[model samples]
Target: MEFGNDCKLIVGVDYGTTSTGVSYALTGSSQCNEVISIQKWPPNCPGLKVPSLVACAGSPGRSLWGFEVRPGMKSFAWTKLLLDPTFNCDSFKVEIREVAGALGILKLPEDRDAEEVVTEFLRHVHQHVCGELKRFLFDTMSPGRVPIEFWMTFPATWSEAVQSKLKRAASEAGFGDKVFTVSEPEAAALAVFRISKDFELNVGDGVLICDCGGGTVDVTSCFITDMNERGVPYFEQLTEETGSNCGGINVDCNLYRLLVTKLGEDFKNLSTTMVGPGSNFMKEFEYIKRDFNGELPYTLTLLGPVPREITLSPGDLRGIFDPVLDRILSLILSQIKRLMQSLERVLSTSKIIFVDGFAGSPYLQIQLKSALRQQMAEVGVLVAPTPERMVACGATVKGLQGIVAQHTNAVDIMA
Candidate 1:
């Protein structure tokens, strides 16, 4: 547990609409190939990430965030989307209305805006990450003494304005003077290529990455150019990255709509009886959605006034999932088509890599695999291991590369 004088720490934060993840690497002269994900989080949330949620009812300095914001608490979620100016447009009316309604019900402080909420949330995340780093590095070295670099991942299609807003928020949250940004799809590609042993890529091989997350689905095509002396692969973009707001949240919204339709008159009791942050119904539906695979019926028991049990049959789940799944598949297919046109040849050895939280859905994997098999029998689709942590881990890898390159250049200069 020793380090050289040139040792540095790299932290990567993946702040999603629904959750956030952190990964870091400690590097020196040798190549740092291993990125450690911060699995332990506040309030004992047992996962690689914590919900991107914040409760601002109390003082701003004492605001509760992540797992600390529990059910029934008046909290803010999806504030990340508000950073985008286009989020208010007709295309995002559904999501925009959802957020507006939640804010209205919560009656958040008039002075606190989306940027402020996001900054506060990230501040908590930064503090927790620092504590974890200090504990992990214990007596070996002081994190404060090392040159720590912070890298954050953003959607590939986010506008420059949105990116700037995110960077500003991160900086205010103590991510340092200069917070680096990595496109989500590129980060996913980096992690998948670095860690995945399921498939090997040769020079000139194409990889299409489909990142299905809580707020957005992004697709990117990368061509493997070469491998470095240390066995790290290099990639070149084959086509423009494509993405849309059609993601897992859309399915949740669909379920909400279905519940409202089914419950009819009784849906009005959800406010006083059910919990905030989209109600207990949505929370229960999340587990059902993740475990669903188009074969069994999932039953949800409502606890509000006039309690009732609702059964979601296979067909009902399909109806809720198909629209969003179709949109994601279209994105992947479009990327494939564009990649083929750019290469002007067949994609015989190419593979499709799925990453991000939504990629863990069994139904999504089954449908994507089935569709790809039908269209391109030779092409293979594989889910990146620990799909949820890919972006954050990949961001760490990118940071590690930067540190190594700088160390190598300094050595050459000294020589």
Candidate 2:
């Protein structure tokens, strides 16, 4: 009897709130080092941070998907928002066809199933990626090469049941039959270990990674060490943590709100508070907060029944955003407290490493550094890179791991 040789093609996808990134690794590559940018600015999609926003359109037989959604203050029902209690999914049905409820699909009919909405979204993303892979491979190989397998990643805390649902959605969307699942943290760890292999990490050395993305706060504490003294890194999970749906997106929301309120002060008798699509005032305020850079005399325009505009100085924006800033600060401090408590119980050390999108903000980074310095004086807290592309980059590393592991196994069996 003869068996087909094992083959490998790994794809690392980061399904973020605002955007989604997909990267692939060949069988023998040292790393999945390339960053694939799916969405860019101008005519921005509904998704903000990245391009995970799925716009459902086209005929009944076939549908279209992409970063084609119009920008501005339009409301978007992100799939991640489903986990938020503020959203009412009780009236919704989760149909398997689209991966989201019919009621929530951007422009679809109102009665669609939730599952259809989600599945359709996932299917589109998969198709887009496959197209990219085809183009990438065309340049590297002849047309007759066998297709590559994919390694789809999910959050570490996702239940197997939820994961099964995602896999089913992908399969239904025509993702090749050969696909696998992985956790986001594991991928992130792989990426960190790959870059810092020379750190001489030991069981006693704790590495804390914080993924401050658009919609969620994902934190992990790991005991990174060379399980085999030969320098191959192994990770031991320590206390992992998250926060109450806090992140850069939330900060944007707060900035938008403040800006709206500041503009309203110009109106008389008639109230000038924002009242559309959640807290309008808060959303505008959040945007202004994010845009504040000590620059003077910035103008903000409000679109509503009575359109209005207001000019603001750096001081004016800061004063209006103070409340929101305080809230975020408190939230960050709380998360740190939780991490410290968890560390005390899980390991004998307290060192923490912070990485993610928020790490890029000078204001946020400075505030965090100062707070951590004051609270966890003995514990080292450091943020790598300002933009916090670690998760996407790390996911790529994991994709490479998937490739290497397969090649190693095949070689062992052949010998």
Candidate 3:
């Protein structure tokens, strides 16, 4: 379970579109066996994440990151979408621009085609990560004693060019030759497999991952190929994998439009136009999003522009979520069915695990459980622990292999 980890560290960064999250573990410490997501950051919060936001406070070199930017300070979000060379600026124009306009940022036209913004945001991430790591090491171990390496996560559906740009961004952020990349879906799968204390997986048992994130829903299935000497599940890919842009963010957008239409432009001007993905109304709406059972209707109260509230019945929530949820469920269920058919065990039970923030929605989890049970009793579904931090946690766990390799190579050279 140990990497040749003396005087070394392993770090993983989940540079998500909505939030950036990180975790660091000493190569030799028991932490190597338990991936710990960094819980502290500037102006400290109790959460394991910070908004993936950046703002131009001055020229190219000066910027504000995360919660550093004050309200109306022209910060940019969804910056990670820039890495997707094929991502349509036009397709996302309204939502992006609304926030940009709200913040008074004017570079949307100029920065749309470049990687500088993404790099700058990641630079902040890297700097903060180093600071946190240094503080921890300074207290328990000597500073400058342990060499650090990074594992960054990206969308499984991202193009190679997009991934290359991400790597370049990491390097520009000062990671140098110490960066590695793992697909978000794979990282999520790894995190779930590594953390599940109960061993329900026997050799040949299949696990399907529905990494339902902010802007994309990726589905990948891997079968248990073998177990490590420690009896950990070893995976082999069983499907081509697929995804779509219909994630939580899309539902957020749909809800946003509905609000604007119902509440009017004045309310829009005063309230968060983005909804729950870091929106002003998130405090009130996020609860509804999580708690609204398909059985009963719900109400959301917003005291903005004027004190006001609105009701969205169970039917209403379904109307907003069904379109997006249907797309995700189809992708996940199809993959499971395909796997079942391929394995020629159509009637036999299989494991399907859901991870990432969207999977935490009780309403969504219920729908998944019911759908799978009804569609086929052979499929068992469970949401992994720390669903919100799946990518970062998984990357942290998987990065140990690289640390061990580097340490061994250094040993070889000395020998």
Q: For each candidate, what is the lDDT?
A: 0.78, 0.51, 0.70
Candidate 2's error at 74, in angstroms?
Answer: 8.1
lDDT of 2 at 347: 53
Q: Candidate 1: lDDT of 387?
A: 92
Q: Per-residue CA lDDT of candidate 3, range 288-403, in tens?
A: 77677687877776655466668877777887787777788888777767767776543344787887777778888888788878887767788887788888888887787654
| lDDT leader | 1
Q: Is candidate 1 or candidate 3 better by TM-score?
A: 1
Off by over 4 Å in 2: 1-7, 29-50, 58-66, 72-76, 83-109, 177-179, 197-203, 227-232, 240-243, 263-298, 303-308, 311-351, 386-388, 402-415
Native-to-model Cα distance after best TM-score fit, residue 9 in candidate 3, in Å: 1.1
Best by TM-score: 1
* Candidate 3 backbone collisions, by pair: 297-314
Model 3 bad stretches (over 4 Å)? 1-6, 29-31, 89-114, 264-279, 295-304, 337-349, 403-415
What value does the lDDT take at residue 236 in candidate 2?
77
Question: How much is the lDDT of residue 127 in candidate 3?
Answer: 74
Ranking according to TM-score, highest score first:
1, 3, 2
Q: TM-score of predicted model 3?
A: 0.85
lDDT order of candidates, best first? 1, 3, 2
